[model samples]
Target: MLDAHLVKNLPDFKIDVNIKSAKGEVIVLFGSSGSGKTTCLDMIAGLVHPDSGHIRMGENTYFSSNQKPFPAEKRNVGYVMQDYALFPHMTADRNVQYGMKSVGKSEKSLALLDQFGIRHLRNAYPHEMSGGEKQRTAIARALAAEPNLLLLDEPLSALDDKARHDALTVITDIQRDLDIPIIMVTHNWTEAEKVATSIYKIEKGRLI
Candidate 1:
């Protein structure tokens, strides 16, 4: 399970939320901008430490006041950011391979690319692909390691209506293929309904 009861005080805002999610569950954190959705995600990924509280992800205790905090790289959680964050200089294959290399998963990475419908675009760079394609590549790269938890922050925010529709299907397909828990943060309620199994909303840092 991905469980966290974190408290963080930001300028002009504070975040205090409790979240619990497990395998086969895609929890959607839906709220307006600055509602601490992304902030809560960063905390779960160990990218940012909560001022106080324990974060337990299955057998791993990512953060605890009494134990050593897990580094971002060691959290065993895959995070896909809003911008897709692909390396402009690298080809799609390279980007996917970069992730595979981190976990000795090179042999199976191509299969994931094919699974996401971007295998042909492997040789193409991010600039060569459409916005939606780049985002799909990023998702495939994140799944290359088959992480225990998947966190996506407004991944479809930049896409137009048609792109959004296609991306949602891809996201759904990815979830169907993996048993891990997924936490998708977005302000789009329709996206949540289409992709999330359970909906969790945060308002002013509190899950309500």
Candidate 2:
């Protein structure tokens, strides 16, 4: 299980939200822009330190006000950012291989590409691929690291209707296959209803 209580004082408002999800659950933080949804993910992913509260996944304590904050690199978090964030210069396969820690990185990356039905684009760079392809590549790269938890920030926001549908299926499949907790942030009500096992609505910075 993943449990977090994040408290951060932003200039506009303070973020104070508690989040919890078990394995195989897709928890969506549904909110408008600047509602602090992404900030919650950042704290859980170790990218941002909360002013107080704790982040714990199973037996691992990622952060706490009293203890030292865990280093981000060691957190083993798989994050698919809002923009996909694929390296412009790297090929799809190489980008996937970038986060892998296992042996046979090339083979693993290829397998993931195949799984995502983007094997044909393995050699293509981010600029050469469409938005959907880049999104799939980003997801593949995030999973290549075999993280304990997954964080997705508006993952399907850039896709067309068909692509969005396809990506939604892929996300569901991934959650079922990996049996890990997934925290996704999105403002789209339809998308949230489609993917979330549980939804938390946020306004300003508080869960409602």
Candidate 3:
């Protein structure tokens, strides 16, 4: 299970939230802009620290008020940022291989691309790919690291109607295959309803 209770004082307001999700579950943090949804995901991903609280995945304690927080690199989290965050200069295959620790990185990257149905774009750079293609590559790269948790921030916001539909299907397949806790942030209720196994609505800085 993934469990977290986070408290952070922002310049304008305080963020306080408690969330939990079991394996194979997709939890949507549904909220509007500045509702602290991204902050929650950031804290969980170890990119931001909480004022006081705890974060845990199964038996591993990622953060606590008393103990030193675990380092972000060691957290083994796959984070897909709002922008997709793919390296502009790197090709699809290279981007996928960037975080992999396993041998035969090339082979594994290709396989992952194939799994996402983008093997043909292995040599294409981010600029050459469409929004949907870039999203798929970003996701495939995240999975390449074999993370224990997945964090997605406005993942489908960049895509058009058809692309969004295709991306949603990809996300569903990922959740089913990986069986890990996926915490996704989105302001769209319709998107949240389609992808979430459970949803937590946030308002201001708290769950509403």
Candidate 4:
């Protein structure tokens, strides 16, 4: 299970949330802008420290008030940010290989691109790819490390309706193929309804 309770104080607000999910579950955090939905995912990914509470992933304790939290990289989380966060200077294949530490980076990159159905665009840079292609590359890169969990933040917000639909299909396939917990943040109710196994809404820094 992926379980956590987070408490954090910001200058303008406070966040207190308790969430749990079994493996293969897709949990969508839905809320308006600045409702702390992204913050919740950040805490899970170890991108932000919680003021209190604990995070447990299966048998591992990722964070706790009494113990030092695991650093982001050590947490084995695959995070796909809203912008896709692709390396502008690198080709799609190289960007996907960035997280890999083993030999045959090129081969592994190509294989991942093939799995994501973007093998033909492997040589294209981020600027040369379309929105869907970039998103696929970002997902491939995130999975290169073989993470225990996946976090997607506003993934479809930048795409047009058709692109969003296509991306949603890809994301759903990923969740089904990988038996890990996926936590996604989005304000789109339609997206949430389509992908979420469970849904939580953040309001005034709390799950509503």
Per-residue error (Å), model 1, residue 107 = 4.0
Q: For model 3, how does the per-residue alpha-carbon lDDT over 14-63 read when each residue is reduced to its tens digit?
A: 99999999998999999989999989989998999999989999889999
Estimate, for each residue in 71-112, the C-alpha lDDT of model 2 and write its tens digit. Answer: 999999999999998999899999999998878998898899
Superposed model 3: Cα runs more than 4 Å off: none
Question: Model 4: which ten-residue window has the lowest total lDDT?
Answer: 36-45
TM-score of each: 0.94, 0.98, 0.98, 0.96
Question: Which scores higher on lDDT, 2 or 4?
Answer: 2
Candidates sorted by lDDT, descending order? 3, 2, 4, 1
Which ranges in model 4 have alpha carbons more than 4 Å from their true place? none
Per-residue lDDT over 1-208 for candidate 4, one digit per residue giving the tens place of the 0 to 100 score? 9999989997779999998988899999999999988888889989899999999998889999999999887898999998998999999988998889889998998899999899999889999988888888999999998888999999998888888999899889988899999999999999999999999998868988
Q: Each candidate: what lDDT?
A: 0.87, 0.94, 0.94, 0.91
Steric clash pairs (candidate 4): none
> Which candidate do you rate higher for TM-score, 3 or 4?
3
Model 1 poorest 10 in a row by lDDT: 98-107
